[model samples]
Target chain A: MTGVETLIAERSASATAVIPDIAHYLLNAGGKRIRPLITVAAARLCGYEGQGHLALAAAVEFIHTATLLHDDVVDDSALRRGKAPANQVWGNAQSVLVGDFLFARAFMLMVDAGSMRALHVLSRAAAVIAEGEVRQLAAARQIATTRDQYMDIIAAKTAALFAAAAQVSPILAGASPRVEAGLEIYGRELGLAFQLVDDALDYGGVAEALGKNTGDDFREGKITLPVALAMEAGGEAERSFWARTMGEGVQGPEDFDEAVARLKRHGALDATLEQARAHAARAVEALDAAPDNVWSQSLAALAEFVVERAY
Target chain B: MTGVETLIAERSASATAVIPDIAHYLLNAGGKRIRPLITVAAARLCGYEGQGHLALAAAVEFIHTATLLHDDVVDDSALRRGKAPANQVWGNAQSVLVGDFLFARAFMLMVDAGSMRALHVLSRAAAVIAEGEVRQLAAARQIATTRDQYMDIIAAKTAALFAAAAQVSPILAGASPRVEAGLEIYGRELGLAFQLVDDALDYGGVAEALGKNTGDDFREGKITLPVALAMEAGGEAERSFWARTMGEGVQGPEDFDEAVARLKRHGALDATLEQARAHAARAVEALDAAPDNVWSQSLAALAEFVVERAY
Candidate 1:
């Protein structure tokens, strides 16, 4: 993690002032650095003692940061990591360009890591993440989105990168195919649990705890897992409420409260949290391939931490 | 060029409809394949007889198309290549995301092209291009951008890709370092010439000839080369006019006409055109490292063609 921090500081330095200015703003915005932590943990679990994993961890964090920058612009987000987003501070144009610069920097770091196979995996993940974003955009106001469709969207958007991040370390370590595949599954399930908790938290958690406004998805007319499940379980009145709120993008002052109440009434948030725990359980199970070292144990506990915060 | 087109069509296809839709809209919008042409011509000049250059050419064009997509969004452009811009058709969010998707796809293609050095060149070029766009954003509407500063902007924004595109094919060919360096200079100088002519044409060329509205730079408050040169050569009245129109972005209906008139009186367009011719001459001279075969001669002729349209 120290090497990752050093690599990030060194690489984010650029000749153009605004490039580094906006980059450091986002990088210093109290981000948890969860993805890079996974990269390092997975690498150490595989006995990767060399410094190459540090570059890979930095690259993973770069990709995540770049996506956050672009996501803020695309979502027109007001706050990120509990602060005004880079787009708000620097303007959308600067944010977009800096995001692009960071993305290219990520690839450059991956190339420096000198593993062509890892490059292939991460690059493919980058493309798929964008595809998932586009898909999410298309599905934003569609309240009738199925559970499988929702899973597919999250799988492409979030889990793909986590899988790549965890898998790339094993590739760098020359670990066996089984270990690499198991870590990838560990990463994917952890990401799924993480996102499930996030979506559930959007309905049930406090705003201060979430670092973003609760009911943000509802305000944006996004049909997340809880909303989708609520829609499926509700009656005709519930359908119209959802149709007016999420589908038609019409919301009153009390609508977010009503939406949450209905989610509670239908046990939708509980259902979502239950699903997250199931995925977290699977994430822990996937760690069976790695030896029970301290790093592997920490990774297993991290999966529990990802979902437990929502409770 | 056929191979390039096929590669683009194939790579731009994605499961998400909007990604491919916007990608095809931009890629099929009558763009002249100038960058990829340079890729093929440079490969041929190095006497390379492999199919790998096709992938490299496709990667070069993907990078160009991705840049155009993002540039339109940053500029809030109405038209591109004589059609409504993709952002106008698909919204800025979609354009930005698709631009990212294409950028990732470009790197993937470079990885597939299988030269780490070329990947390095293209990735570095991508970062430089973004830096240039950011600098250009900072320079916009300032009314005091220096000629050298403007050169640096265009060199990064436009010429960096050309240089990489020309250099990569030789890397694939395993050509001598001298030939590779020569083509890089040729591409860089040719790109500078092309952009200079483009700026001059905004004030002098016809609407239909340039595929978009004339005086777009003036309306957008961009400090292009012609405007920078004109400001340097102008008096007090010209200064105030530019300050109001370009610096303050308070343009009246006739201000574009007046700006053109001032450009003519100051010989700015002619001066810009003269600069283009100088770069074109350098581009031709850079070809001395390669044998004077048909491919090399074609590249020299192409450089001349880049500047001739403005005259």
Candidate 2:
């Protein structure tokens, strides 16, 4: 992980001042290394000690960081990871260009990872992530967004990268295709569970704990699973309430409390957590093919922690 | 070029509706395909006849297209290629995401080219292009920008990709190292020539003819060589005029005309053209190491056409 950090810091450096400035700002913002952690664990569990894993880890982080920067801009977000986003700090134009710089830099780092197969996986995942984002945008505020649709969105936007990252270390290690497939399932399922918990926390958790204000998804007219489920389970009154706040984009100050109250009344947050738990269990189950090593054990614990964060 | 277009259309397709929708719109907009032309010319001139060159050509165009999409958003322009830009039609958020999709798709195509060396060249160029864009933003509207600084910006943002695209086909062809380096120089210098002509035409060309409104750089306070030269040559009143319009970010409708008059009076446009001509000649000269085939001759003529656009 330190090697990954070192590679990130070194690779993100550029003669262009704002390229480094914005990259440093976003990269140093204390982001969770969940993706890199998965890559490292997979490497260790698969008995790969080559330095390519570190570079792959760094490339994965770069992909994550670049997407974060662009997502902030696309969402017009003001803060990320509890501090001012790079877009807000540097302005949108520089943010966009710097995001591009980081993205292009990620491909270069992947090349350095020295596996064309891993490169293909990561690059394809990147394209899928972009597709997922576009689909999510098209579905935003459309209240009729289905659970299946929402799942597809998350699978593409968030879980695909996780799957790709997990697949990389094993591919680099020349591990069996079965092992690679198992780790990939582990990653994708864990990512789905993690995102479900995140979406649930947005409706149920405190702002300080979450490092961002609650009701942002609500405010942005973003339809996550909980909102979709609640909307589905509710009657006319609930539909109109959601329609006014999210569909019409006309939220008053007190509207968030009402939204939350409705979520609680319908037990949507609990159901969402339920969905998350099932996914986490599947993530653990996917690891049955791997050896019963401490790394795999740590991975199972991490899956549990992801769902626990909802509490 | 048709093969390149076919590949772009095929690769940009996604299960998500808007991914294909926006991509189709941008890729179908009758772009000049000059980058593909350059790639094909290089490949043919160097005695290469592989499908990898076609994939590389498509990848090169994808990189160019992706940058153009991002550039339109970063500039917030309303028009591209004589039509409403993708950002305006689909909105900025979708434009940004689709741009990412195209960029990632470019890498996939490059990987399909089956040459890691070419992949490295294009990826590094993409990063440099982003860095150049950021550097341009940092140097934007600073009336005191040096000529050398202006050169650096264009070289990175415009010429680097051209150079990369030029190098790819030759690399796939397994041309001699000296020939590879020579083609790279040809590409970079031709790109420099192309961008210089673009800048000059932005000041001197008509809006309808250029497919974009002139005076955009003046309005955006983008410091190009002509603007730099005009700023340096101006008197006290001229300085204040430029300072007010570009430096202070204030522009009136009449200011564009007055700015053009100043450009003519200072011979800034002509001097810029001279600089472009020098680059074009250098571009042609760089191809001397290659076979004296029609393709190389066509490249030389294309360089002339690039500079001729300014007139």
Candidate 3:
């Protein structure tokens, strides 16, 4: 963790005053460093005793931070992690540019890791994440977004990075192909579980714990699994309600309450949680081929922790 | 040239509907394919007869296109290459995301080029270009921006990719380090000349010839070398005018005419043109150690063409 902290500070440090300021501001804001933790844990599990994992972990964190900055702009959200988003503080243009700076920094760190395989994995993930974001944008406010489409979006936007973070370490450690594949699966499942929990929490979870309002996604017209499911089960009135509030961007103070009620009536939140738990189980199951060590044990526990956010 | 075109279309083709649509809209729009041409010409000059250069050329173009998409968003421009900016057509969110997709696609091509050296060169250039944009953003509308600072900005933002595009081919061809270094210098100076001509044209060139309107940089409050020079030469009244119009963003319709008058009165455009020619000469001179091939001759002519835009 200290290694990640050091390298992150060193890499994000820029001569352009605002680049590092905005980058470090969002980076230092509290969030679970789950992606980097996965990277480091995977490297440790793969018996990588060298210092290379530090840079790799930092690189993964940078990529995550970059995407978050860009996501805030795309979402037009004013806050992140209970603080003013970087875009709010520095404006959208600066946020976009700094996100780009962090992306470039991520690649620089990847190059430093000295693994072409890691570079390829992470670069491809970066692209997939962007595509996923665009896909989400296209699906925004659409009531008919299918469960499969939602899964695909989250897999590319979230799970791809997680999988890349986990898989690259095995490549660095020169582990077997089976080990690499197993860690990738574990990371991907864990990522899906984590995102699903976040989506469910948007309707019913505590605002303090969730770091933003309970219905941030709802306000943004994001068609998450809960909303997608509720639409599928709802009758004529419920479908129209979704269309007006989300699709037509006509919302009032009471709209969120109604949304939560509809979701609960349709068992949408619970169903989402159920899906997350299943993925969490699969995540733990993925470690069957990985080395059994302290890191692997923590990783298994981490998978459960991801789904527990729904509670 | 056809090879570059085919590869660009092939690589940017995405299953995600909007990604390729937006990318191709901008790619197919009429802008000279100068960057990709430089890449292919560099490869040909180095006697790289294989098919690898096609992908690399396409990759360089993607990087350029990606930056242009993001640049439009950052600059808040309404037009690109004589058409409505992609942000106007699909919105800023899509433009930013698609730019990211192109970047990822560029990296995928670099990986396919089968050279770590090429990957390192282009990836580093990508980072430098992003940093250059950020630097430009920080310096925007500042009358005190120095000529050296402007030179540094153009070198990083424009010339870095050009140099990288040229240098990469020799690496792919397994040519000598001396040849690689020469191509890099040639590309760097050529790019500098290209950007200087653009900066000068922003003050006085015809809009039809330039593809975008004249005074775009002025309208954006961009502190190019011409503006920097004119500011240095002007006295109290001119400085206050610039400060009020550019620095304070208090521009009227007549401000652009005034800006042009001040630039011409101070001979800033001519000075900028002189600097461009000097860089163009250097660009041609850089090929001293490179192979004396038809590609090299064409490259030298291309350098002249870049500066010729000033006339």
> What shift in Å separates residue B262 of candidate 1 from its native position after superposition?
1.1
Best by DockQ: 2
C-alpha positional error of residue B195 in candidate 1 after TM-score superposition, expressed in Å: 0.7
Q: Relative to the true structure, how large is the alpha-carbon lDDT of every model?
A: 0.90, 0.88, 0.88
Model 1 clash pairs are none
The residue pairs found clashing in candidate 3 are none
Q: Which window of 10 residues has the lowest lDDT sum in candidate 3 chain A?
A: A205-214
Model 2 CA deviation exceeding 4 Å by range: none
Clashing pairs in 2: none
Candidate number with greatest lDDT: 1
Listed in order, each prediction's TM-score against the native is 0.98, 0.98, 0.97
Every model's DockQ, to 2 decimals?
0.82, 0.84, 0.69
Candidate 2, residues A11-32: lDDT per residue as tens digits?
A: 9999877678888887887777
Model 2, B294: alpha-carbon shift in Å?
Answer: 2.1
* Ten-residue stretch with the least lDDT total in model 1 chain B: B204-213
The CAPRI-style docking tier of model 1 reads high
Instruction: Give the worst 10-residue stretch by lDDT in candidate 3 chain B.
Output: B203-212
TM-score of 1: 0.98
Q: What CAPRI grade goes to candidate 3? A: medium
Give the Å error, residue B87, model 1: 1.0
